[model samples]
Target: MDLLMKSLKIGVNEKLYIKDPESSTLGKNIVEQSILMIDEMGFDNFTFKKLGVKINSNESSIYRYFENKHKLLLYLATWYWGWVEYRMVFATNGISDPVKKLEKAVEILTQNVEEDSSISHVNEVVLNRLVINEYSKSYLVKEVNQENKDGYFVVYKRLVNRLSEMIAAVDGKYPYPISLASNVMEGALHQYFLKENFPTLTNCNDSITPTEFFTNLIFRTLNQNIHG
Candidate 1:
């Protein structure tokens, strides 16, 4: 009877055992496999079965960590944000000048897009379709609304504000509005990405890359603001 009670106590504390090295490694493996599958099949097409096969585990094992596909995608999205934040922090580290900061920020953005082409493509497709096709779906609508309420756009706004303050610091008499310039810069990047990836509608040649276009346009915008 004492042995039985001890066993029950151990069972109850099994989650505490999750700190064990083997269990931690298994957990990392699951997330790593999920990311691999997402990069290969994209978020929409990724399935528990696929991840299970990839990790040599089963659907039940994945469900132990993630509640469902939506939860898994959320995890992936959060992971992507972590990656972006890491890059942004490293890229902007030690840069105090506002104009230099803005330039570095734009450079980081372009480099991130370039480095994570597959993930970026998947995100673009999902976000674009969500805005158009799935807005009426409750989950989709809620996700989109939540993103607008608390995600990248907020970060972007803060970055813009920083850039504006930097611009103000540089020149007291500068006429170009920072907020407007930030919007234009973001718009230019979006348009450049779309045109580079979907040139048929954009009516532009495929010779130019998004990075190239973004670099040129960003410098041109800054130049115009300073000169014109």
Candidate 2:
């Protein structure tokens, strides 16, 4: 996503919020600075009290929007996926060929994020970093089944289903469309995670982007099996 890309705005799910953070300055600060802080310090060390002190607000004020840090993380993940879906929709608006559209969707899912001004409070770049590092925690929790039932995972499912449709369009009999779609998303992040901290574990080198790597990977796998 281009840091300078315009008009890519989206809203977080209401189920993820106790009160809409975008409605108030203090709430916005909680969402904005929390992303920055969590991305910097990692999620386990993050707290509303610390975020409150950083944002120059009270702990109680931050709690007014989020039940806990976990819910806030859920909010961030929900927002990120919704925003990604928006990007996919916008990027492939007029595309006809399923292969080309699927490739573009992979690019949207895997590309590096830059700062976006669509929202005044959150930085998409840092939020994407948090998603890369901390996304699994959002759903890899004990309450995940309950949260999934509550529709917290709808945006993510929508993104995968959208791409799976494109995959199915290209090859109606493709049996692994949904699994492949989810892999493209998760695998791209996994590659980025490996490259960022454990460079020796991956060949992500300085030339090819994770986006390009996964796009090529998916197309290659699909091409080999899509027609046969």
* Best-fitting candidate, scored by lDDT: 2
Per-residue lDDT tens digits for candidate 1, residues 16-63, read 122321245666576556555665665678788888888788778777
Q: Candidate 2 vs. truth: CA RMSD? A: 2.2
TM-score for all models, in order of appearance: 0.56, 0.93
Query: lDDT tens digits, residues 44-119, model 2?
Result: 9998889988988789988889889999999999988888888789789899988788888888888888656456
Residue pairs of candidate 2 with colliding backbone atoms: none
Give the poorly placed runs of model 1, Cα more than 4 Å off: 1-23, 112-140, 146-197, 200-207, 226-228
All candidates' lDDT scores?
A: 0.50, 0.85
Error of 1 at 127 (Å): 16
How many residue pairs clash per model? 0, 0
lDDT (C-alpha) at residue 204 in model 2: 85
